[model samples]
Target: MPNPSDYIALGSQSEEETEPELEEDSEETEEEQQEEGFIPVMESPRVLAEKESKNGEATVCSNAGESGENSQGNEWNRGDIDGLFCPICMEAWTTTGDHHVCCLPCGHIFGFSCIRKWLQQQGTTKKCPQCNRKCTLKDVRKLFASRVVAIDGESQKRIQSLEAKCISLDKKNAALIKKEAEWKKKEAEWKKREALLQRELHQLKEKTIYLEHLLDVKPRTLGHPPSMGGYCVPSLGSEFNGQGPFILQKELGVDGARLFDIDASSKIILMTRRLQGLGGMHVLTKMSLVAPYTRQDISLPTGSKAVRDLHICPSDGSLSLFASLGKKLSVLSTKINNFILAYDLPAPAWSCSWDLNGSHQIYAGLQNGSLVVFDMRQTARPLEFVNGLTSNPVHTIYSLHNSTLPSGVTAVLSASSAGICQWNFGGSEERQPVVLETGNQGACISLAYCPSSDDIIASFRPRIDNSNEMAYSQHLLTPAIGQGVQGSHVHLKRFGSNCYQKLAVTCANVNDVRLPRSAVMNIESHGCLFASGDELTGELVLQELPSFTVIQHLKLRKQPIYDIKYVHDVDGGLLGCLCDDILQLYGNHALK
Candidate 1:
């Protein structure tokens, strides 16, 4: 008999080949044979012939009588046959010879049905059941059992079919991989272009925004004089031996006109007292630079008392009009289209001005010789009040606010019948205000301090003045007991200097020297110009500061001028005058 191991060497021989049997056989002991459980069986002649008829195909079956034996002397069971049982189900794979043996690319073996079921359970992973290695059905090979064999011709045919299928699959896989790579490259290019377009759009938006800002700030052309309440009235330029640039353009009739202001946009606000009535009126005149001089009159509701001071906020074009009738102070708000009144004051507000430091704060001088500061942000009450000065009425309030002052110091220069003093609004209540160069300049009538420079222009009269030297007196003056000027004189003083210089004494008979009340009166803006009205001659003199040379002078209609303001705008300086019931605009048309 032949040993099947000699014929079934792994991949060594064809399925139909067999090894020749030996002439002699070794005898085994009965007890050892029983322990080995070697079984042998004889086959029927009809089965053997039928198996050989199929082109020499063969099936090696285990002999039942020789089964249940272990060659290693261990107990033999049905699970001991190599490659004959399903590793997944732990069942005999050859029960009906329906299940085939399968091998994975990882070299692990399992029943074909078992591995197939496991791969389907794993979905796309297709892991082998025995070794858990990743492999799909394409990577799996159907392995044949050593006992089952096909003839040579049929085995060659199966190999050729598998090789053709593998080549076709490889071609399809190469095409898909190349297509995926191309799609990724195109997506990257598209994203890059999209980012570039976004940057361009952002730059365009920024440039558009910058152009809009330039349009807002750029000064437009003032093609013609503004449309006035009246036609153009030629200025009397050579009346007082004056040959300067300013010239009168329009002369309007505004009765009892006291306080007037012109904003940067040429908008004019005139505060005047009703000649025969109890209340006063505010005439808001909007003057457009680029005109046919545009003028639209908006008269606000009048108050019982005469409006003394008018202030227009530079930050916002809000109007603040102070009335001397009572403690009433009205704020004309164009934004809200109404007036805000603050009353119940201890004394009448004589003078008012906005903070020169470009804040929302306002300063007022009261008739009771007190100074009050108001924050327009919160109108409940004033932020600070300084009292206990001399009982003489506070006639002028000058906000000496500038960037050159020490930080945290908010001071104002106020003038009263007593003297000129500096009040620190940012200080405590107990701190006494410094009286800067105060003396016989009796009751400083008008005060102006330049925030950007050291120039301070103030006009005052002696306290012991004769009745003849009063503001409107036409009588001749007598030398009174006063260290300063007798009637009124303009003093230009530096910030840290003790001595004050008179304005060059350029003009004679100067009764009430005045400065422009507009907050825009810096040296650079208004060219250091101060104005004075001669009481006897009724001449309005415009003198430049430092070298107080006369710029221009206009003789009026024998009436005393109350105040004059320089219209601060791009078209040089325009002068506005209030004399009796007339409102005159000088240099309005010619400067442009």
Candidate 2:
């Protein structure tokens, strides 16, 4: 109907209305959770204005911005809010890329960078203008990032529109919920009447049957409205089993192989299930069934934007996904949809993974040689930034351990366009980053941390020094897995080690055989499997992973598989793939 944006306006209105109360409620719940053990997360703030006053600027660069051992850190800590206020806004706070903790004669903390940028525009400098005290801010504590403001009336208007749309969508959902409840009530009433009618008909039938016997006559027959319930022309007395549903994941990234065959080693079965029905490029968390775990909508900013990567926290079962839009990285929550938070990035984020640090924090690595830690408790800023990384962008961010590490140290590794580096959380950003060069720097395409050894599996363009670096390139470009294995079987390569000294395969083009784009896909959680659909060909392929082996391929009434999944059902976990509007099931022979 009336356009989705209209409803979002209402959503924002509602969010704003209950924000204060929600914040208070959150505070209370946070305290109670502390007794149990939980962490908090995220950022982005409101834009506002204050009465005019004075402007002050703080800049840390050249000698001051140099990386070194932590010198005079926190020495600049001032008391409560004071002189850091902008004369224009008369507000004691402002925000900049660098989360500045400015020392003020009036004791305030705002964006040291934001204030400086504001001062440049005014073309004048005033001393302690807010407190009217002498300007004397000694040390500038620059722990976070620094940003240049590019905002004006246009951007503000755009933000307002998006906020409005979010609110409106929420209202529509609420109304739909109410409508569904009413429909259910009506259906129940109709069902009750139908039951009474059926009883009356049964009585009539019994009476009619007796009369027929007494009169030596035949009773009329009733029939079902034909064919929707199938009548298979089969070899008599034979039974047929239909296909079921299942979950499917595309791959484990370029780092390793998909979960299907396990490199054909002595197979190990840790907890696993293929998530099905995820065909779209974007992976988001929409609603939360578990309370205390905030439920949030996931929506991309309007236009042709797509998320870069997806990660599910094995700890809380929460999902964390990030999008690469511009220079800045937008942190997206699968739990929250319509609402989004922006985090200023030091560099374009190449890759990311979620790791539960100490049960309360989520450690996300960035392209900028550091691990960005988001404390779920405080949305104000990142709790810590673990330093020591390569100069190039960090290509991969992943976890080494599923559980908390011993000695209170968690092993987290990051791969950059240049090389790979590892770090623990308790470190300072002011030290020489422990850098490691993985022999060459030809853009690390993919990386994964092996749980067994501290070793990392990296897929990169081979070094020119190699005798047949050309051969290496060819191998990397090959299609590592495919569908033509058994009659309709898909084949996947098992996991391989990076040392090419371990495994190797190369092909001319992987995209040539690529299927039309899908919106969603899921894999069965049983052991390992992949859901496949070819809308152009009117085919659905359920392929096993790691082995590139196809288990089944079916030709349904040509429908675009928008999503595929393995669902846990009354019979057993089944393969559930969606095409167009209907869902078709493929049951495992065992389930039947």
Candidate 3:
């Protein structure tokens, strides 16, 4: 290891003395060179010269002297010296010191003292120590600054790219923040709307509770009077020794009662009545048949508005089926006093009935002139639907258990405004209904069926003249003997051999100026008796069946009678007559 000072002194000696010293310096290992903090120049001067000449421009070294002098007039600071060093000593260059910053004509930078000493020791040739270019002491230029800085073109381009990337990232971040704010605003609005809806729901529930309470307490003052002035007389042809069979037992006044059904096993009558505050909504009222006759009002499920028809299940006394104007057929459990099953219907239902043949089948008569059949075992949908002969509403339906029909055939009798139709099922693959011919009495308004007698009684309204020619061409036409009568007609017929044979027909003063009225028939040991409301005298008329002969007249109010039901059990016979204002119960005097 030779001393660094000896190498610097050897540069000024004779050529023969310096040649061996130069070889020794060149033989130093790369590790030694790096340890000395010396960086080798990558580009040769010849290559730089060719590149400059091709561009038709002088080398940067040629302009260094002029640039140095021009820079003296501008302000100089320490910041201008970033990343600048002298190539000869590998040390930082200063502004005003013995080893100040300077550049040779070859554009190579060094300390001023280092370059001057290098040129003097090179004798008269005075070549550049870096590029071997001939130069004198006057060719050396001094930089006028407190510090020196070198501009790296590649590093400056890299920093510009990084700055542009940072700007793009900032824009993306701002967009994400804005989106987050918008989502938060939407969430708050939804929460507010939810709170409002919850408040509305609570208010509706309170209103429902109040309305229910009003219905229960408001009708207590309307209790039935002790008597409604009813009387019974002996039948003209009966074998009762000139005494009537039935007498009034009690009267129950249920305000707003529309329809009712009696379950003998449970000894309760289920009736439908409108709510006080909510007139359009109707619910069930259960009344006990015993003394004191305790009553309970039951609220129906939502959407079951006005019930059109109600009936107790013949097979299961605890279950009752009803049709509603709400376009639903619902089965309610009287034991639990709640709706157990419901079915969607296409149109409002007018009547419903259970199969009296001890099957799981049930039937619904729709207002659209269609009959829907359902099996209690399958609740998802109806078993089948049959379209009626006319589009008029089927107001009455009954399941027939006649022994005269075929063994495999099951029959259902339904009556509408058009006529009476017997629907037969299970006999053949294609079962079609047959319309019963009853000599065209009038529009069938109501129907009643007796299982023991296999008899059907249908009431009719006077026929209306719908022909256009008759109204325009009539000059003087005498009406038939009973054609111009204002009252309705009642017909008794037997159903057998897939047809109806007329048994009796009589003019009745009932259902004349009113809507359809219901009638009932009861089986007695002597004979079967039929009862209906007589609008002319405002009385209940009891007539012997198959003859339509009047037996007894029980006086009632002038109000219309909407429904009647009769059932006989171990407790003898019970008769329930529902009028607009009161419900009257009659019992068989002979059986009691």
Candidate 4:
């Protein structure tokens, strides 16, 4: 009848216990003394728990310390955390790591794997499993060091060596510098090809899902159905509850979320791309923040359409779409060509993805210091980016590619008004930046990761609070204004979540002026399908990620367009789109 989490809260609430709970806590003989006079020490999480970005009053206990006071070993890492040696067995992890590791909440180290069974047999209360300091997370590790491991282990020297190797490996990678020029050209070409292929492939799949209409119809034969539960039942030739003579309805639409062509059996993790705007540094507008509303007259030929940011479902490669037409985030789905949500944004959002944990649902980074994490389970209002930002707005987010790092360890390494800062999950540690050089500094605008090669591509610029639309670039830096820099120093942070920290940065491009925040948003990882936009001109630019010189000039389509979608239906194996709202269905036998 009781809630389990409530039990976890209660069970975990041993900041201190009654002398009464003592017999219940017999494990602590020394804890009795500490409880009377010991000061608190810092005890870090064995691994940080899953937490929301927001923080509030914690479950306060009487022992809560005042501000600025550090807990025991809170200043860990200065000395090896695994330095203390066990006086009982006198070695690093006397037996197995599990037989005796540290317990969180109250940092006492113990071999409960042994004491637990010992306690059960005697029907005794567990005091301090170690020195019984009446365990609180703050003093636990210290108690363990003082009691469990009175003598230091030989691990100190080994730890120092390991730490040194880790520090050295963090450097040694100049491969990014060598590949810079080639990567620039290759990125440009791939952009075009990826855009076209992703669009076309998406459309083709959509057509197949609804293509049953393309088949010749045959009349149905109906007989007694399951209606005659216990009796003989006649079968119907119709795919529905019918007989040979009746008509039936064809299949349409999908289940859950939207009109998705997703496979219920799919197990792959899909990575979708969607955004509201882009940011750059500009003399006209100190911070070049551009979204759906900031349009310009670039003087395009007739029929040159602008493509909006796309909504893709990475789970099954199925996609829904959203674009801006009359200054709103339009929802492009199979049911409607443009189901527009009449909403306005401070600046259009640039890009978004599922945070590594898949806990917060989606994290969307806007042009300024405005990143938002939307709970996938709830779409009412997103947890705005500014709420979690301490330094600057998150410009772009990269999914950390690592198996060594735990989930939610790395997040949107924001390129804000100031510099780069990682939005660590909850109150963890801050991420170090491998930002662009000083002169070439501003907010980062875009991010793309090449799985083929281990490179995360990004773009940057300056602040964008005051923006002017047309003829904006001509404005010069005022004597006292336009503090934003050109930012020739955008570098890629490699293995950001690795234990062996690695850094890879981009080369100087003093003259590579980043364009004003535009719709040019997505970077496809599978070597094809790129999407960019001219937000001001309403032109959607689609291309493919190419590798070879010959593959360079490809586009998802030759003509500029406004929106697109990609889907794979149950019947239609794979489909992609360029501009069509309806799916032109076909059979598997039909060749493209």
Query: Pick by lDDT: which candidate is best?
Result: 3
RMSD of 2: 36.8
Between candidates 1 and 4, the one scoring higher on lDDT is 1
lDDT of each: 0.53, 0.37, 0.66, 0.32
C-alpha positional error of residue 121 in candidate 1 after TM-score superposition, expressed in Å:
99
What ranking of all candidate models by lDDT puts the best one first?
3, 1, 2, 4
For all the candidates, what are their Cα RMSDs to the real structure? 23.1, 36.8, 15.2, 37.2
* Quality of model 1 by C-alpha lDDT: 0.53
Model 3 error, position 319 (Å): 0.6
Error of 3 at 130 (Å): 63
- Clashes per candidate (backbone, < 3 Å): 13, 104, 1, 102
Runs in model 3 deviating more than 4 A are: 1-229, 232-238, 467-485, 495-497
What digit string (tens of lDDT, one per residue) describes model 4 on residues 1-592? 1111111111122435523332233354544543665343343342112111213112111122221135342433413333233223323232223344345344434332443333333332334443443333232332222123233334667888898987776654455565786899999999989855754454344345334322322222124322211111133223223321111222211101111122223311111211112121110000001111111111111221222233443432232333221223222222222232323335444444544434334555554446555554555665443543432334345444334455545445544345444454433555544443334444454444433233443445444556432122211111111223343323243453532122333322221223322111122222333333332233332332231111111112112221222233353322222222221111211111
| Candidate 3 or 2, higher lDDT | 3
Which runs in model 2 stand beyond 4 Å of their true positions? 1-306, 317-319, 327-342, 357-359, 368-370, 386-389, 402-404, 417-421, 427-443, 448-592
- Per-candidate TM vs. native? 0.49, 0.32, 0.58, 0.30
Tens-digit per-residue lDDT, 1-592, candidate 3:
1111111100112334322211122344434533664232244566456545656322122222234346566642433322244556645444344565567665666777888778667665566665566666666787543223344565679999999999999999999999999999999999989856754463354345434534553453245322223434433524554556676666666666778888888889999876444444566888787745666667776786788888898878989898887888989888888888898999988888888886578899988789999988999888888898877778789988847777766778898878888897666568878877777677776788877676777887665678322222111111111222344445556656476677778887644323445555665675778888776677888887777777677776436676788888887888888776478787776565
Q: Judged by TM-score relative to the true structure, which candidate is superior, 2 or 4?
A: 2
TM-score (C-alpha, index-matched) for candidate 4? 0.30
- Residue 221 of model 1, lDDT score: 14
Quote the positional error of residue 60 for candidate 3 in Å: 42
